[model samples]
Target chain A: MDDVLRQGVEIRLTVNGRKHREVVEPRLLLADFLRQRLGLTGTHLGCEQGVCGSCTVVVDGETMRSCLLFAAQMDGSGVETIEGLADDPDRLHPVQQAFWDHHGLQCGFCTPGMVLTAKALLEENPEPSGAEIREALAGNICRCTGYVFIVDSVKAAAETMASNAPRGESP
Target chain B: MKPAAFAYCAPRTLEEAISLLDEHGYDAKLLAGGQSLVPLMNLRLARPTVLVDINRVDGLAFVESGDEVVRIGAMTRHHTVATSSEIRGASPLLSHAAGHIGYRAIRHRGTLGGSLAHADPASELPCVAVTQSATVRVTGSAGERTIRADELFLAEMTTTLAPDEIVTSVAIPRIRPDEGWGFREFVRKVGDFAVVMAAALLRVADGRVASARLGLGGAEGTPRRVTEAEQALVGSVLGAETIEKAARVAAEAVEPTSDIHGSADYRRRLVHAMTRRALQDALGRLEAGHG
Candidate 1:
C-alpha cells in the first residue's frame, strides 16, 4: 500500500488519432485531462456527476462520461472528442452541418456532446426514426431547443450520411 | 467537482487486487466502472484513501452459458449484458432489465459486479438477481465463497461483502421452457432511477400456477421478494381476479419510505399497478407458448 501513494502515474494513449504520453495525478478526471492538459475545450462539463451528458466523449468506439473516468484509466485507450469530428473549418461534418441547417442549438453549451453522440448513433445505425433519434440522445440534454430541432438534426444527418454523400468520417 | 486525492493501483490480476484490499482494508475502494463510486467521491460523500482499479484485471469480463445456468464475470459491462446473445437466450429477463439501466453511456461503463456491490435498491441488476435467485461469488485473502442474492443486500448502498472481499462473478439459473417473466418500472425521465419497479415470474402447469416469484425495488431499504403475494398466486389459475389479489397483497406487504421522487403512498400504488401489469404480461407470454 505504501508504494501505491506515488505522486503521479504515467499514461500513454491516443486522442483523436494523436498519441500522447503524460504523467498525471490519479485524482485528475479524463474531462480535465482533455480540457486542461490537451487544451481541447470542446468537451463541456455541466453536472460533473454522470447525469448531464455535457462531458461525453467516445472511448474505443463507445460514448462515455469523461467526468466519471480517471485520467489514468485512459492509459491504453483511443478517445474521440468533438474536436476530432471535422478536419476542415469550412466544411462541417454531416451531423454538424445538419444541426446548423436545422437550427439545432440555441446556447450551444450542449452541442458538442450532442453532435458526438449523434455521430456514434449514425455510425451504428444509418437509418433511425425520430423516436430512435430521441432515445439515442436522451442522455444529452438540450435545454434551449426543446429537443424538437435536435431530433430533426439527427434525423437529417442520418439521411445525409446514408445517401453516400461525400462525408468526412463515414458517420 | 474533483475527487479528493487518492493513491491508485491498477492490478493486473485478481490475486493482486485481493491482497491490496486485504492490506488496505476499508481504506481502499475497488474501481470497476467508476459509475457510482466516482460520483460519490466527486461530491465528497465517500473519501477512500486508495483506489484499487481492477479494470486491467484479467478474465473478469465474460458471459458463459452452461447446461443449467449462466455465469457472468463481475466486470462484465451493462451494455455487454444487455446485448449479449448468450445472456439474451439464457436469461432474457436479465438482458431486458440491464438494457433499462441508466443510459447508453452509463451502460457502456457500468458493470454487473459494481452495480450489485454498490447495492442501490432502485438499481435494476440487484432486483433481477434477487428475483431470479442468482448466486454472487466473492473472493478474499481467506478464500472464495458464494452468497445468495437474497442475503447479499443489507440496506441501501450496503451489502454483506466484507471489506477485504471482492465480487468475482455471479451464477444465475437459466430460465426454463415453461417459465414466463415480466419486468416493469416507473421513472420520471428516460434514464432516471426508478421510483418503483416490479418483477414477476410465473411457471404455469396444466393451466394453473405451479410456482410464482415476485420482487419489488424502491419499496423498501432493500429489494425483496414478496412471499405472501407469491404464495397467493400458487395453485390458482392466473386469471385477472387471482392476479389482482396478488398485486393487492404485494402492495400491502412492503413498507416504503418517501423521497423527492415520490411519496410512500405513490410507491405503494405503483407497486399494485406495476405488479398487475407485469403479471398480465407474464400471462400473455405464457399463453403465446413462449413460456
Candidate 2:
C-alpha cells in the first residue's frame, strides 16, 4: 500500500458550478471538505450523525447527507449547497426570503438545511401543499419551535416561487 | 469520532470486490452505503482489518421484476424502493415499509440488502421479506447461490451469508393486482427503529382467502412466520371477525420480551391490534383493486 501521508487522494469535484481539483485525506468528510477546504461554510453541521438535516447538500442533483459521505467518495459529482443557490443581485431564492420573512429559524443552525430542503421541494413541485411541505421536511429536525413556522415558510416559498418560475423542468 | 484503524480498498469492479473478499475472508467487510456498518464501526462494535468499499462498483443498485418475482439489487438504497413507481405498483407493501425506514437522509444511504444482512430484529425489511417469501442471492468464491428467506436469518444480527459471500440481490414474488398486503409498527420518534412490527400478505380469490403469510419483528431473535394465524385465514373469507381471530392467533404465536419500548404483554397486545388493522387495510385495498 502507499504511504499513509499519501492518503490524500486526488479528487475532482464541481461545487457551485466551479470545479476544483485537489488532493484530500480520505477521512475528510464531504461536509468538512466543503467548509474547511473549499471555504463553503454555508452548509452547517448540527448532529454529526445523520439525524439533524443541517448538513444537507445536493450531489448530482439529489439532496443527500454530506456528513455521511467522505470527500474521496464524491470526487466526480456535482455538488450544490446553499452557496450555489443564487448569485443574481436582483432576486433571492424564494426559500431564502421566506425564512427571512416568516421567522422560520431561531438558532439558525438548521436554516441551511431548511433552505436546501425547501429548494428541493419547490423544484420538484411548484405548488406544494402544507402537508407535503411538512412531509418533505421530516428529515430536518428543528428543536426551537414546533415546526409551525418552518412549514409555513415552505408553503409561502412554494407560492412565491411558483409565481415567478420558469416554464421548463428542473435541471 | 473516526472509526478504528482499518485498511480501505476501493474496488472499481465486481470481480475485484470478490477477489478482495476472497483474499481477506472473514476479516474483510464490504462497505456499500456505510449507513449501518459505519455507525457500528464508529461505536467499535465491529472491528475488522480491511474494508472493501463497493460504492464505486457499478450496476448493483437496481430492481428488476418479472411476472412472478422482483429482484432488487443489494446496493440499492432504501429510498430507491420507497420512491420507485414500479415497486409501488408491483409491491406496495415493500414500498410502504421502505418509506417508514428512518428519515430521508438515512433512507438515501441505507440499502435494503444492508438492512437484511444486518438482520436486526427491530428492522422492517427482514420481517417483511419473511412474510412475503423473498429469496436472497449471495455471491462468493464459489460463484453464487440463492437462499430462501426462511433460511437466511438465524439470530439477531446474524444471517446465513458466509463470511466471504456477498449478497448481490433479493428476489420477491410479484403480488397479483388483487393481492392484499400491509405493514404496521410503532416508533418513538420520526426516524427511530420500531418497537415491534408486523406484516401480512393475503392472497384472496373469489371473495375467500386463498393463502396468507404473516411475520413479526422485535418479538423474537429473528422474524418469524405465524403459521397458526396463517392457517386460520387460509380457508376463511377475509372479514372482520376472521381477521380478528387470525390476529389473536398471531399474537399467541409470539413470545415477546420486555424492553425499554414496551412490556412483553403490551407488545403482544399491540401486535394483535396492528395485525387486525393491517388485515383490514389489506382487504380493503384488495377489494378496491388498489395497487
TM-score of chain A of each: 0.91, 0.91
Cα interface RMSD of each candidate: 1.5, 2.9
Candidate 1 segments exceeding 4 Å error: A1-6, A165-171
lDDT by residue (B43-83, candidate 2, tens digit) is 56776767788888888888897888888998998989999
Residue B213 error for model 1, in Å? Answer: 0.9
lDDT of 1 by residue, B1-291 (tens): 789889999999999999999999999999999999999999989889999999999999998899999999999999999999999999988999999999899999999999999999899999989999999999999899999999999999999999989999999889887998899998888788998899889999887899999999888889999999999999999999999999999999989878988899999999999999889988887888752
Give the local distance difference test score of model 2: 0.83
Please, what are the lDDT tens digits per residue for candidate 2 over residues A102-138?
9899988898998998898788888888877887888
Q: Which consecutive 10 residues in model 1 chain B have the weakest lDDT in total? A: B282-291
**Which ranges in model 2 have alpha carbons more than 4 Å from their true place?**
A1-6, A88-90, A167-171
